[model samples]
Target: MRIINNKFNIKMISENFGRYKYNEVDKYIELGGFIGLKVALEKGKQHVIDELKISGLRGRGGAAFPTWQKWEGGIRELDEETFVICNADEGEPDTFKDRELIAKDPYKVIEGLTISGYMRSAKTGAIYLREEYTYMKHELETVLELSREKGYLGKNILGTGFDFDIKVFSGVGAYICGEGSALIESMEGKAGKPRLKPPRIGSKGYLQMPTQFNNVESLAVVATILKMGASEYAKYGYGDSIGTKLISICGNVNKPGVYEIPFGLTLREIIENVAGGIENNKKVKFLQLGGVSGPLAPESLLDTRYTYEDLWDLDLGIGSGAILVADEDMSVIEYIKLANNFFHHESCGKCIPCREGVHVYKKK
Candidate 1:
């Protein structure tokens, strides 16, 4: 639990805010929020990627792919116009970690993306935020504007000449838009739909340019890895599953809040300590680890470590950091019905899989 001793040196946003309150504009500036950009500019691109690669940071957006590898491939394969997209379209029903990052510390996300842009030599970055969370999108935009005005987001950022800028492109309210390829299509002002592999997005992505797509949490960790060496970061969790995770604990919990805990933290610990246990004095029956697409984990696996590799054994995943603790009263069938309804309504009706799939679910 105590990751940092004498927290001033702790570069991560969550670590710095243990007892500190979010009060003034000066509070963030003093806490090394955008300092990563300055460091990246001085140190250069390869140094940034090497640090993340050593940190063993995996993607927090369900798939848990290596973050450094994604950046490296995008940089090496693509030209200067290579893009970085933060998939803030958190359409997962109960997941709100992305929203929390956008609301509480938008600067951290921006800082991380700025580092990536500098390293990849990217001209543009996009934060594809969900339209449902209008307030979060607005707040993120305000923070971005403030950073830009302060010379953190615009040309000659921190006097490094590593030019990068980020824009918030609100999606037209579709859950599937969270997918990397679907996001690219949406950004291109077309209907959001997944593109086929063979020419994967990393090689040819985002308006036909190689793009590195990361969830908000994954990018936020990049901010810390830049400050703390990767070896030190790897000490936190399992092999290939290093660094902490930001999970949104909701549904039937006495307290529902997003907590950034180490990777191996148990499900029980999350439900009892972080989420303040079950609601209405009810007993927890089961847990839905990811969002709807994620497989359900029974009570027997409560002691399991919340990691990508561990979840993979059960054919489940920590998709989108959505930890829904279902009480005995919650109906599984009803929940499925609701999720199906969402899919049905949001389907663009373009592809056979989505269109016919939605139709079948709608009829059900």
Candidate 2:
């Protein structure tokens, strides 16, 4: 639960992590907790979306899709029944930022989801909690209850007549359910499996209604963007990839924990300055950005910037923002084998390519 890079001054979500007991509603409000929601209610829905656009806040859930576009689509759908979901089924290996967010600052997520519901006029919001995180479910439920008592949840939030409520649905420990469509399906009481695109989650999702799906980190930042003003938040990150990102660095790093880092920092900077270099002062062998499925980068690629465009250019993705650093003592083949085994076990077997490909790779 260690957080670094606080001195850099770009701590949007992590700003109040250690300042106070954020889990309590009063303490969170003392440090500007639901003020973003209040601002969103005051400015109206379109204003929120516009600010999100100006903020350049892409989806933090690996896809890096435009957050504003999804909200725009949900508004345009014209479906009376719309749903907003916070994808908290963080099954990515070494990625624990979402869990930390939920445990430390559940109110931020609740406010973000409520604001999202306001954006889409959605009555229902869901935080798809991972099964491994079930232990925190009671704590979250208690917070939700407190929010309801405080008039943050249920009908007529903040005297604005914007009625929204959130429910926490624990995942069944299926990694594939981390995908948007599969998460929707699982919520619908079906087996967790990825759904085919075309009727993207924007149009037909969650009981065949227009749904806005956002990752835990993506939704969490929504409140920050609105509270701090989009222009102010947008000034933090690199071009296109604006605002800071929550990166969970582990595997041979001296400081293995989550760090809020501004975009455009080199991989070497993150590994060395941020994570305090490799463990035992060993030389670096390779680094895996995002997660197990993310591309591997040797020491030669350490200079590359961590922006979305830079990673995409190298066929790399900031999937789940999990950085697994391997020292010279580790074997690349063994690492790949471990990753392959994970995929082989986690694949839903609905898609032939992923299903058979993982099996074949495991056999190899």
How many pairs of residues collide in each model?
A: 0, 0
lDDT of each residue in 275-309, candidate 2, tens digit only: 99998899999999888888899989999988888
Give all candidates' CA lDDT scores: 0.76, 0.86
Those runs of model 2 whose alpha carbons end farther than 4 Å from true positions after fitting are: 1-9, 358-364
- Tens digit of per-residue lDDT, candidate 1, span 108-170: 788888887876778889998887876676677777788788888879887767678899898
Per-residue lDDT for 268 in model 2?
A: 93
TM-score of each model, in listed order: 0.88, 0.94
Poorest 10 consecutive residues by lDDT, candidate 1: 1-10
Q: How close is candidate 2 to the true structure, as a TM-score?
A: 0.94
